[model samples]
Target: MGDFRRSRLSSTPVVGRVVEWKKTHGWIEPECTIDHPEMAKHQGHIFVHGEDLVPKWRNLVAGAMVEFFLYYDGQGLGAEECTSRKVLRVTLPWKHAKEMFGESGEKLADFEQQTHVTIRAYQWCQPDGNNSDLPFLLFEIWGRPQAVVESIGALAARREQDGNAAEDTLCVNLLLPESRMWKVDLMQLQHYCSLEVSSSITITDPMPCRTLTIQAPLPHFRSSLHALIAQAACVGNLW
Candidate 1:
């Protein structure tokens, strides 16, 4: 009888929306009662604690969708191991040399320079053609200020004229549990950022490896680009 009761009360993963969230605790409203009818007693409310959320820094925003399991914690129904279904907007910090002509290449006085990117959790097929359960973050750099656009264009033009084709690529080194390098075309970057330019550059396929060194035309630019990728990884919980 005890086992039966437990089975009846506990539920499989269910979809719900966060109705209210405080820093410590919150309430979620289950979308349906197909599996757990007891939810009706609490008016479709499921208790969720901040500790139960995955990627802990990301607190559930009100009205955001979530997937969780229902279990009776003696006192009442609660959620456990909750996963949020919201896209994350992350800011990638970038700092360049204050004076490019300087020998030491001093960094800009303001360290707060940044651009915004959107990241969403996705399931991607591995080279082995198997769909891994691990969450892959798909991020796009969508925010390009006029200054940034001009800077990138100048760097690309300078690198292109040098005749080293590799220097014209933007290298994104993902420092996750498994490190990987993704090389994107400088021209593609301009295009994606809505810069008016024509180019015959083709996108490079993602190169997965245990370790790789990130390269760029200039040292300061490489450092800034590295920081930007690191920020994205941190926000996506891939670090």
Candidate 2:
């Protein structure tokens, strides 16, 4: 299950067309003018203009019905518009998602911290606008979504002292697709079932937040691990 806190606060799916793209917005890249009916129906829904930090997204055209996720921050305004926040992910057509997010395509893993992986799509897009340059006609690779509904308490704890297996006193857990996992040579447990490693002698420390994406792995488990390891070094029984 996805984290209830994360799902409720962030990762709200919004559907709308790129109504406009004004060059006058700025220099780095144009501002996305998304028109979602949810805003009108909800009354106080704010017209959000999100930024696409992905340089390749420069080809996005107006009038394209795109699926995207919004970041959340409690505010007095009816609908929060985070100019600083970009789309958590954009869902495109299935065939299109493969071409775009597939290995040879956009390869979003190279950029974003992919997690809470999912596949979603809308029926169709209006027959107007220049959506040909768009990767998928009706599908999107919903890459980043939410944190896993898990906690440190849910994870089994263990201690290690020597050998490469026990080398990591603690580590952040990350789940990655087999395909992307192949390209990345980071040290990972071969068989991690039930959040447990398959054959790793090392005791895996699942990260506090269970993220689904393969994104880049975190170096250290957490700062707390440093102190814990330091004290454990002397006593060897603090855990």
lDDT of each: 0.43, 0.29
Best by TM-score: 1
The prediction achieving the highest lDDT against the true structure is 1
Give the per-residue lDDT digits (tens) of candidate 1, residues 124-165: 466899964433223222222333322332323233526776
Candidate 2 TM-score, C-alpha based: 0.23
Which 10-residue window in model 1 sums to the lowest lDDT?
Answer: 89-98
Candidate 2: tens digits of C-alpha lDDT, residues 1-239? 11223212225544333444454221111123434333234243333333332332243344233334443223211112221211111223356445545644456443223343322233333368533443332222222112211121112132353655444343333332222223332233222211232232211121111122211112233222222222211110101
TM-score of each: 0.35, 0.23
The collision pairs in model 1 are none
Q: Name the Cα RMSD for model 1.
A: 17.1
